[model samples]
Target: MSETSSGKPGLTREQLADLSRHFDEDITFSRHIRAKVKEAVPGEATLYIDVQDFHLNGAGTLHGGVYASLIDNTMGLALISEVGVRTATIDLNVRFLGAVREGRVTCRAEVVHRTRRLATLEARVHDDLENLVALGSGTFRIFEKQGRPLV
Candidate 1:
């Protein structure tokens, strides 16, 4: 296996896509919302979502739910990269610090803590200009899979 910049095993695009596909059923809106998995590596992940009118709130800013969804997926991906399995978010807390009117929003997540049964992760959502729009943390239940194709 190749190594990522962080010295973790470089997950192939196929492996990443497989993990993303597993979550699609749970986060179906990700497709409609134009979310993309930008990067996935052990303990780290980045996701991007393009802001469209449909993603806007009544105030014409990005909806809080969109940020929450992005954070959940990003953090989940980070955990998945580390554990090579699916994870279900159990507790998620988000803080809206600012708002985005247009352009792509990026979410970067890191696995902060992990144990046999659960993982704790943190994420930050930023606008195209790299201004922090939201901050989030979540806990997820890890499920180890048997004979699942990873690549």
Candidate 2:
């Protein structure tokens, strides 16, 4: 549960792609939510998810659950990309400020703090037109990995 330098370093672009594949294929819940990594590197990650009709809430806006899940996933992926390791979510806090009936939702997460024992991350989700739809922050327990998260 640490971000020790001895654990690992950020992944290469190729590794990020492979990780994305594993995310889509191995994480069953992800198949339902379907967020894709647009960028992943040291200190930062950006992810995107398109709003399908199913993603809407009863009132016809993007579901609040979608905001929470995507923000958490994107923030966690940023840590994984930075450390080239896997992490378990310790806590995730989100605030939903706006809504969109349809279009792409993007999240950008960045490492806020990291140490041998813990890492903190922050993220914001925006609609295609740049509306601030959500805000999220998380703490995760980092782990040293022998390979990809699925491996």
Per residue, candidate 2 scores C-alpha lDDT tens digits across 25-136 of 6777666888877877667888889999989999999898989888888888788777776688899899989978989999999999999658999999999999898999
lDDT (0 to 1) per candidate? 0.83, 0.81
What's the lDDT for candidate 1? Answer: 0.83
| Reference-based lDDT, residue 134, model 1 | 98
By summed lDDT, which 10 consecutive residues of candidate 1 come out lowest? 142-151
lDDT tens digits, residue span 1-151, model 1: 2455666753555676676665453456777777888877678899998899999999999999999999988998888777776568999999999989999999999988889789899999999999999999999998766225354
Candidate 2 worst ten-residue window by lDDT: 1-10
TM-score of 2: 0.86
* TM-score, one value per model: 0.84, 0.86
Q: How many angstroms is residue 121 displaced in model 1 relative to the true structure, after the best TM-score fit? A: 0.2
